[model samples]
Target chain A: MLAIVVLLVIWWVAYWLKLQPPHLLPSPLDVWGTFTKLLTNGAVWEAVTKSLQRAFLGFAISVVLGTLLGLALAQFTLFRRAFGPLITGLQILPSIAWVPAAILWFSISTEAMLFVVILGATPSIANGLASGIAQMPSIYPRVGKMLGATGFDAIRFVILPAALPGYIAGLRQGWAFAWRSLMAAELIAYAPALGIGLGQVLQQGRELVDMPMVMTAIILILFVGILVELCIFAPLERYVLKQRGLAGAKR
Target chain B: MSESTIVPDSSPRAVAERSGLHVPESLIDAATAVSINRVSKSFGNDLNPDGSLRAPVLKEISLDVRQGEFVCLLGASGCGKSTLLNLIAGLDSPTQGTIETPGGRTALMFQESALFPWLTAGDNIKLALRLADVPKAEWNDEIERLLELVHLGGQGSKRIHELSGGMRQRVALARALAQRSKILLMDEPFAALDAITRDVLHEELSRIWQEQDLTIIFVTHNVREAVRLGQRVMLMSSRPGTFVRQWDVDVTGERRIEAPEIAALASEITTDLRREIRRHAK
Candidate 1:
């Protein structure tokens, strides 16, 4: 994109002019050299695989928990009145804020990392489903009852399908928060037992004051985020919107 | 076609009847399908000084829908016609008194198709069939039969969005039929359609009504639509809606939406409806 071109040009200018110092602003080529060296040393693959595996596991748990929470909050009036505000409050609280407590309780382990990721992603996912259920057209429930669908049957067949589009969008947002929280956990809770992940790579670069290595890690993080958006969220949303015929229902 | 005769698949239904598929012997009347005895509905809590409820929508409404009868409830915009229909459909209960549809559950068709977009036409009917306790093995055949009844045969595979507006309504009708309930309540089911489509659907509905032996309670503001379809049209007054008048439509020939007899009766009903509306202005 033109924005990438502009960014590359600015970086080249800063590096060429030695705006700060040779140590601070490395050329794009230098960053590329460091990226290739990491790839050849197998650190890039090792870090990517470990980080992504954690992301997958954490996200899977959050989705299951979030969906249950969303349904409970949406269906049971007593449950919603009790826990809805509390869950929403949890959403606004930053995942990074949990790092210290998590480190203490989990002692710089995978548990510490997963604890933060699950906490970060679950609320957004739940809220997504809650909002989706709330925004469902009134006709669905009424019709569901007319056809003898009561309680759980109504929730499963009518409410769930009607809330699907919103649920999917929630899933995408949950994934975003999940990835970010995982990275933050990695950066803060780096240790030998945790293995060499992207966050650990960035932390190592920071300790060594290696500019090119830091840039490579940041680019990889952004790359994964963009890749998920393009490969998963975009197509899923398009399919749902198209199949539902967004314009047909009044909403 | 009489109840005593054994149709080809009557054995299963016979067994189902014994197993309480239809309403029990004591509760069900052979002639009447739905019995609404002095039923009333209201919205909101009782905040009045005398402890009367706030905003009564239907006031002491009474009606009996006989087996295979086609009755239409005609009224102005603010009338509790839809609220009454909802009460009858069991979507909502009467705030006072009771409504008894002793012929098992009823199916209601809304103005919009209200079909699940994620489902194909067949699947929509399948849900209704499933809820109605139709056997799983017979689902494919039942769906085909119902779709065919609505003149939508072999089109069950199509997505709801792929169908035309008229087709969607037909699919909705098929879904309602799939419920296998003796009663079908429609609340302005074709109000959103074009004139031509509406007219065509009316004819199809009349044919389906007789063919399927359904007792229908159709609600609408359109008087001509009521005249064109109902065997008996009940005109309701708005604002605490109650039946003000009733006309037994007995045209001796084919009834069209714009037939002279229909127009004449509709105009008479319109005059009364206008008077009811005028009363609100004061």
Candidate 2:
């Protein structure tokens, strides 16, 4: 309550002082008004839905590719020797760094944005899976073999389940990468054929010097990020960890 | 019972014939459930280029377990008791010699429960059954029966973390039993529990062994545990582990851990084990 009150006080003081003029630094209330206006006109819903669809499509591909890559890296020594360092290097490379190549290949279209999202997320997901497999207790495989589990049956019944915690953590990180990469791609490449998203809204607001619109887009991005994490990833992770008795009581 | 009365049978064939009573023809191979023929195990690549210096972890050892027999391998920490158990479980191969088990599959239980954290107690048993090629249709009934056999019964839905240490070991026992193997190899399964809990588990194990008519090869560093559980206890020496001594415990009726005969036998083994350790120091 105190933090909110302090923030409100700062907002009101800034408006009253007319800091940096109304057009450049719009009051918090003006930003709120813009958000309500966007909601009433359905612009916010349209932009959010389009962005979510692209994010989901790209992420789905990443999940399949990443998990397979991770399994290969863990199971085969040749794959580990070949691509392990390259995968780490890709993870460290910023999502925005892929934008130039993505645009060059796909010509600033939805395909280009998707390319960026997949590149941004795949390495983290694969690396997460690899590390999880690597950290699994050696006793598990021996136990599996004693039970007569062999080859793919061992991988399915023993290895995959044992490495789930790390895999899920990787996916969470991958989602973050996918979202940021999508936004970066949107800001850089203005493909009129592709629908407007929050990133595009922010970019348009900058060109028009519409401060309230820029703030509105920023708030929406933050809200979506928090919402997805809380609704999907957090609960999924907690349930899995708790079932394994890896988690303590929730606060 | 004196130390001298507990004699080592150098020839296991004679011992098996003497102990062979209830063993079935199909179940027993030449009246023995397991035959360890001059077995030896070593770690790392070929030891000492010269063949004279043999530092194998387990040296040429020969022993036999009669069908439905309860045998304990007792020694100090580095005695390769676990190594011997692993060789029997087929988890590792002996460097020399052969271990023959005519009874087909064998189940191994570790000191730690080794239960998959992701699986419930029932599911863990079910997985064991599935891996052992038990038909899917019988899994539900078999799972319930196995749980009840371990005294778990309706607690099948409970996760591994929900179980106490003794309960987890019971669940592990149920999982091993799910293999439907004639032999059960336990590596100090009760070593992690409290004294009270260990005592309870010992009774449970003895009861289960009798009920199932299972051949058990239990490995432990504890002397009293061996006396309380095993009909015969085999002691091993540590450095280049070798089967050094054996004691055939002849106790009528169900022997409790605190009984006078059990205590007397345990003390004798403890003295021998201490002497073995002392020899290592020299």
Candidate 3:
């Protein structure tokens, strides 16, 4: 906590000294003022809620679809050989790149945002699950078989649990993709029903030429991203790692 | 050794007579626990239509384990002991002959603990119960019973990573037993442990084996381990694994590694194994 205070002091000093332009990077005081103004209006909160809802909805869909696809890809060699390359290729395409296609298909609505989010996230989720299944030790499945686990029972009792760590890792990566894609979709194409997210706030600030508000929006986006990671995914991942004894040491 | 010495006479009468009073002939006929008949396995394929001959891992191996008997397949490294165990477990098929396990289900324990990291120890055992079609009501009791059998009663809630190697293997043993299979195939289950822990587990395993009255086919490279636990030890040759010799051990009552007969039998088997390896070198 003291270290954080010291770092803030250093940042304040740098800002007072005008190390960079105020427009490109606003002073801490200016960002704080803008933050208070936005907070009072309740619009920022609404945007935040909207963004989170989209990200979570897309993430949930990706997890279910990716898990099913990954299982199919891992289990059926014919399916893997047929579509494995395509899945990987899909993952490499940028989420922002899907905006125009999604807009054309779903036509500027929450559906369009969801399509973008799923497009950006599903491949990673699928890949994570697939690799998890692939990396499981051969002995586990044999042990499963000897214990009379066959077909779906084999997958439920043996395969999924064995592959869970990797699958969880995939979900973490998928969330990142989902969040980023939702932001890009909102920024590029705004819908009245979709309302204003942080991405739109940044666009509005840019159009109004209010550099302080723009900087505030950018900082809030970064802050929200870090906050979600720290609050939700980081703790989740840590719990899993600690359970597996992969965490380095306990305090 | 002659072919007759290499393969045991698996005829029903011979097995019934050899298995002694405890194992009934009706059980032998009805419950020929595992039959590996002239099974040969080799990895890799040649470019030629006739197939390039990769050396065989197991060559014309035939063995029969009667119901409720403890048999150890003992051999050094590269002797294809694990391959044979895999064949019996149906994880892999033999290149030449078929293996018939009359018992519908078999359980296997590996050299490593092989517990799932994502699950608690009790959940791991419960998975076996779920697979075996045990009613959900019985799962809790059955899991506790298995944990008790392995002397790990309070460790059901522990994670695999939290347990020591010995404890993990104990949980693994419990999970395997939870299947309640008629036959249990173990591939060097204790080879990774320290001497003291291995000794303790040997006693634990013997006690469990007696209680369960389950047929066990254990594979190990450890000579003393073979002598210490097995009712009968079958030594295998290296490369193309074939039974080189058999020792019907009579050390019945609380035998230890230092027991005179055990040391003597281990020495004899070790010498036989060394000679077989030397013959291959020549």
Indicate which candidate wins on lDDT: 2
Worst 10 residues of 2 chain A by lDDT: A189-198
TM-score of chain B of each: 0.86, 0.90, 0.89
lDDT of 1 at A100: 94
Q: Which regions of candidate 2 deviate over 4 angstroms?
A: A1-19, B1-11, B14-30, B51-54
* Clashing residue pair totals per candidate (backbone < 3 A): 0, 0, 0
Give lDDT tens digits, candidate 1, residues A1-251. Answer: 99999999999998898897887888999999998888798878889899999988999999999999999999889999999999999989889899899999999999999999999999999999999999998889888988889988998899888999989988999999999999999999999677978888899999999999999999998898779888998788887887777643322
- Model 2 C-alpha RMSD to native: 3.3
Clashes of 2: 0
Q: Relative to the true structure, how large is the alpha-carbon lDDT of every model?
A: 0.86, 0.87, 0.84
What tens-digit string does per-residue lDDT give for candidate 1 at B1-282? 112221111122332364334433432334778878787788875646986556788878888777777889998887999999999888788888778887667889999979999889999999999998999999999999988888899999998989999999999999999888879999999999999999999999999998888889999999889999997788888767888766668675799766787888888888887887888768
B151-170 in candidate 2: lDDT tens per residue? 88999999999999999999
Which one wins on DockQ? 2
Candidate 1, A1: how far from true, in Å? Answer: 1.7
Interface RMSD of 1: 1.0
- Candidate rank order under TM-score: 2, 1, 3
lDDT of predicted model 2: 0.87
